[model samples]
Target chain A: MTSIAIPRPAYAERPWILDWLMTVDHKKLGILYLYTTMFFFAVGGILALLVRTQLAVADNTFVNNDAYNQIFTMHASAMLFLFIIPVWAGFGNYIVPLQIGAADMAFPRINALSFWLIPPAGLLMFSGFLFGGAADAGWTAYSPLARGSGVGLDLWIISVIILGVSSTIGAANFMVTMFRMRAPGMTMFRMPIFCWTMLVTAVLQLLATPVLASALAMLYIDRNFGGSFFDPNGGGNAILWQNIFWFYSHPAVYIMILPGMGIISEVLPVFARKPLFGYKAFVFATMGIGGLGFSVWAHHMFTTGAVLKPWFGFMTFMIGVPTGVKMFNWLGTLWRGSITFEAPMLFALGFLSMFLIGGINGTFSAAVPVDFAIHDTYFVVAHIHYVLFGGAVFAVFAGLYYWFPKIWGRRLDERLARIHFALQFIGFNLAFFPMHLLGLDGMPRRIATYSESSGWETLNLISTIGAFLIGVAMIPFIINVVMAFLRPKDQPNDPWEANTLEWWTTSPPPVHNFDSLPEVHSERPLWDLRHGKTAH
Target chain B: MASHAVATQHKQGLSNGMLGFILFLASEVMFFGGLFAAYFIARADAREWPPEYLLTPEQVASGVKLEVEFWLPFIATILLVLSSVTIQFAVFSIQRGNRSGLIRWTFVSIVLGLVFLVMQVYDYSQLHFGVGDTIYGTTFYTMTGFHGLHVAGGVIFMGIILARSLAGQFTAANHEAVEACSFYWHFVDVVWIALFTTLYIIP
Candidate 1:
């Protein structure tokens, strides 16, 4: 394949700083999203270390109780809101237009607006620390308690509302771009799996994030405006907060993971040397997860006694079916194929194994009796981390490694990537696996200290060690990225032998993604180009 | 290249701008849906429509009624519905190449939107209690205040359209902004009707 030598203008000649701030370029904005979210990830990671350090031994007083609450609150806030959620947006921004063969997002200015909203919101959220103290109401911010917190809670509410607005607008942009901007020959069914997941994720975000905004607004009014929406003293039901919060948040859990599932689906097919096992089924399953996402919100509130436990348990258990279908589809794609364990594939495989545990453990909670045992315990904490960190974060790294060549026109060092993966996989299990046992043995979460006689010290210390190892794992990833940047952009456009429309263009695609796209005949247009068109 | 660009634009009935606006309105629906759910929950839990918990027994005995008067807000609702119609007319006029008609109707819609806001504020002044007075006052103000803000936003949007219309920016072939403005105006109008139903006529 003789690639066209398109003359690209030199970015070095211009002032890149000013260019970045004012630029509505989708690629640049995607890069900004990546860098900003990764920074928050580091902040969140440090706070995690603080949390682990506090709990590493019995009766530890590394920080006072109030400060401990703030630390964990911000940690989850930064990871969930600032990092994991927006990082998918980052990947989607960079890859979706390229995959769909569009030059830019449907609304590039709004895309920029979405990216710009994050930093200020992050600042406002964390700035709670400077204003007396930060929000300690946990991320769920269950009311009467949340209503009673300091002005910091108000800041958190306002910040989350702003972020919700950003996600809502961004989701709309993604939907419009996919709907309106697909290249001429690509039909909806023929679209790539990543795009499919994004489409589903966007729907979840658009409809669900606003409910969170509404929840936050009520919290704000209740706290400041003498409103008694959640104050039981004022004829307000305290349980109303949980109902509205989970109504948005359960769908939000899907919002966090669905795109990661998309990334995995993309990576798996390439590494296994096959087309995706069940393209249509995978699409249907994604929609199924999204449709069922709304019905299971009460599962989160089951122990509160306000929810219909049997109904919520039934719906929550039903969620696993679609999720199981997805799991089988991934495994089926890997079976009977010429597979290789490249960095991206390793992380993809890592996501598969760990997310399985996440899925299985979540079911234990779906059983109302078991949930009664572990509700608000370290076990539930373990369940979330396995899903978000093990599932979403692993896929995030997989995506970063997979797309590094295309986005930057360079490759991350492969050997260092393996080391990073090993440390993360081992460290993650060592960290969270013990928490399940600890919870079953009656160890509550979010506490700063524990008694030595409780038999929890060994596990807590082991978890702390694992947490540090996870922290150590970042060193190799950082080094690999630095090394990749120091080297020249020498990778080919099809470095990974990929099948998507994105790989059809230049390594760092030209300003307008493509000079001309090949006639897309199926989902794997590039594969069709390499090998003659399939019988389908 | 020009032909390729045109082909890529995807000429569907709904313009990308209009589609995006509707999706945004879909999210706005969920936002208001949440507030209404809270209102219903609050109402259900209370022994009375206006829970006497919020008022001092003396104030409650002073014959202060928590019931909302329907007349002024009904008039405001009618004005808002009329504005929705006028904005649609503005969009229709633009589609037929009548820029003057578009500008005139948009200006009238903006005027009606402003009149509705004025009436709402007047109604607020005539309220039997403050926002802090009771859960009834709280839900009433939060829901309607949010709708009022959306109306204000719609007016500003129309103001922009009116300016652009005066500048002759829109055409029969291309008036996505006008169309989007109308969709948003209609959304605000529908929300006001829901609010009027919930707060004024539900009892």
Candidate 2:
């Protein structure tokens, strides 16, 4: 076959600062996304500390009632919106094009627009606190109460709408890039698993995020224009808000985690020194999870007395089947394999164990009677943290460690990574585990204070210590990153004996992603090449 | 070096931009889907369409029926649908290298869209109930109002297309913008039809 015909733009290199500020380049945009989201993660983490501090010993007055509302609400908003959701986009922006062997996203300007939208939206959302108050209705923003909150809620609404637009367009970009920009001989199935998960995630974002925009629009009208969409006395249904919010949000749960799943899928295969067991099954499972994610939004609303409990319960339980399929997929990959516990592999292993607990405890909510007991309690909180912090955050670190050398052309200190992982792992479980007992002890969520007579003090204190320890864990990670950056960029391409097309290029690939293309003959094209199995 | 760095083998079908626009339209469909679901849910929950009895005693004294005005919106709907056809024609013309025909049809479509928006605004004034009156008025105005804004947006889009056409930027082979604009106009028209059926025609 003739060599590919890439259209390289006529170029004069701008100064370094100006280049980044005006860049339509995918790599720079991806780095920008990473830095911005990690900043929010820290911000959100601080808010979580506030929450935990306020709850530490019963009736502790760390913050007043209203402030507590804003604190927890902003914590979740920053984490889910500003951090987790966009972090995957960060990783995807960097990794997807590389994995698929594309030069850049299909729409590079739109990709830049997607990244640039975030910082402003994040500022707008947090800016609410400076003006009277922040949105205290929680991230879900169940209406009526949400309708009447301070001007901050309005800011929250518009900020979220802006975010929805960003993701919606970004999703279309990801879908198109993956669909249209693979290197020769890289078929759909031969595409990296991370790319497949991102494809499903993009589909979810394309379809689901706009529904969120409409919901936010209605919310804005109700809040500002005196519309009655959620006003019960004005003949509106309150449940309508949940229906619309979760329609996006539940899929968004997958949106928040699917790429993390993608990351872990990539990591596990590389470290295990075998192909991902049941690659086709894993892809189907991802699709299954995305599909079932939509149907099971009502599971969140079971206690509202507005949903069909049995049907939602059944669907929620059924979602676990695909998730269960994934568990076996990972285990099968590890079974009888020469698995090495690299930093990335350690985090991947961490995801498997912690996410299993998250999955199991989440299924407990699928049982209607059990949910009735745990709804609006810390058990629910524990479940989410396990899934998000344990599951998504762990996978994030896995990808970060896995791709750090390639992205920065420098490797992180291994001892520090293990220290970071061990501290985080211990601190994470210590923080969230006791919440299950406290929740069963009938401690409600979002409360500013609890009475000491409630007997929740000891467990609460332990959880707070754990929370701070998790804060302590970040020190090593930050140090590792800074330390790595201080070193020279001397790492080779394919540092980990990685198997994707990305490793086929230079570390921190050039303006055009590749110098020359390699013919892909399997999912692990690099492996095939290294083993001399693929024909050039 | 420039010659050696060829574009990678991409799956052949719709161009990336075109496929992206279509996916964007799918998201638009779901956006409208949310508002429609709100309408249907609000409709289902209410004992009456307007929930007139739920009104305050002051609103009752103010003589709000909390109902939609039909005739003008119906006319506007028809106008919007016709605009869809004209925009389609504009796409067809541009595809065939008929630059004059493209400009003419796109201008006609834009004019029709503006007229439809004006008619819808006039219809909004003629309605007895304000958006604040009740859920019925809320859903009615929000859905149609959003749809109306989309129509205005589509008009602006086509106006740009028209401007580009007159500038001689389009040809048989390179008129993706015109095609994209037409897809949007038709989408806005389809949404209006749904709104008209749900809000204006059903009763």
Candidate 3:
């Protein structure tokens, strides 16, 4: 028997900085995204802690009113634009090519460009804090308030537009890569659900992001050029701002969560030791969620009195059906299989449970009466944090654990990861769950302080403690990553015994992913490999 | 040395440039869609569509200016649309190993694209309302301005393909660059037709 030798190329000799600057390799860009997103995550996390601390004691003078506003506003902006979206794009860029058995993303140079735009956008946004007060209007930056603010708001607008450009370019690349670059046998139906969800997400980004860019440009014109796109006195309608903003912003929420859902979809099946329970249903549910996402933007405008309440209310409730179907599907995937409570699995479970609570709270807000009562309160804050942090961030962690081996070719410290998950789950709930009560008790959101007699002091303190616990939880996870990176270890090609085709490739796959493209005959090509069935 | 052979073992598939063009067009769709939606919503709610109060007496007196009189754009649009056909012919000719035919059509297509762009610039000069005049001006200018930018991009692409054809870089067996450029030129032509009908003929 003759054995064929596959030649390995020596690593290219280049200076470190120049290598990163010019390289089109997806993995390098992915690492760049990871480090950049983590940096922003830390900054945003600190801002979150500051907000929590100020709210910890009623009538507290931890920071002045203006400073508190800047802290919370930048926190939301940083977390949403700079951290969550970029991190997910980073992951998608790194993994989707491997998942589909492609050598590299279809447009590798554009992928590099997409990753490069993010840090500059983050800098432009955060630089405002040092120069003046950061944007005081919330991340949503509703018109009259955003318009009324100073140069900081202008900076926020510019930064968001830049980020939108980055997202749009990245999404365009993802869509093209998914459509044209799949391996010979990797049919669309046979592709991993993560890739499918990303495909949907890229479509949404391509279609929706430019609207936000246009809206922001209008806002800029109104702010600086004496245009009247939003100024009521200048024959402009403020509701126009809400309509246009939410048109993009509603789908923007999906942009944050759909990838997380994709992560959970990938994670649950592996832990359950089964093919995904409802593969087609899950795919349809993703599209359904994305499709219905556009119709419910008016729900965000319930307080504004310009929309038809009954119609918006009904559509908002309708959004729950597809979301609920996804919950059931995730649970069904875990129903009877030999379930393992690995760190990634645990985070997936946390995401499911916490997202349910967030979904239910969202439904409550859909009711016009309930929304009117809690419109500007801490309840909305709690609900959003539960959704964004508990749902999306948890799923992000799950993906990190699940794919860490594939990217780095080493196992992250399992013990440290589990410890990190426990602290985060507990601390996350402790921090955010009480805000619902404080909100129902009439503590309005975005306020810098409250009177000592407001009856919200103890809960606020507990939330602050939880915030610090989250900070502590992050320490071990960071240490684990550093340790794993410094002393690299080899992992088996299929570390998770997973069903997906991505597991078929070498860990830290070759620059061109496959030596020869593998033919994909089923959703679980790797499963077929294990079963002694030739997938090609 | 063996690594170079391994890298080239997989026959180079289509150029990534085609993917870039498709992606660019998808984003352009959203950009135009947003403007169209804004125009529709504004037109729907206004007591007087296009707000007669906002128009100048001369523009109003001219009985709606028959948006078609932006006829220079029509000429530009025709030129662009014909260029798409010529580019495709060039692509087909290349596929049949007809080198001279490919070069001839490629040069023709480039000339048509350049002419289209020149006409577009002339049309911009004749506009009665500037981008800052009113909402009508804003919508009109932004939509066509972006489309003009796309046309400009197509012209640059055509120029590149023309240069490559002249250099004998593309063979009959592998002309992905020609195919990709033709696809983009066709897309630009389609977008112009849609813009012309919606912005001019439909009203």
Which number leads on lDDT?
1
lDDT of 1 by residue, A114-184 (tens): 99999999999999999999999899999877988998888999899889989999999999999998997
In model 1, residue pairs whose N, Cα or C atoms come closer than 3 Å (at least 3 residues apart or on different chains), thus clashing, are none
**Worst window of 10 by summed lDDT in candidate 3 chain A:** A1-10
Give the clash count for each candidate: 0, 6, 2
Model 1 misplacement above 4 A = A1-14, B1-7, B58-65
Per-residue alpha-carbon lDDT of model 2 for A272-299, expressed as tens digits?
A: 9988899899999999999988899999
- List of clashing residue pairs for candidate 3: A103-A513, A185-A520
**Interface Cα RMSD, each model:** 1.7, 1.5, 4.1
Fnat per model, in the order given?
0.71, 0.79, 0.21
Residue A470 lDDT, candidate 2, scale 0-100: 96
**Residue A336, candidate 3: how far off, in angstroms?**
2.7
User: Model 1, DockQ value?
Assistant: 0.68
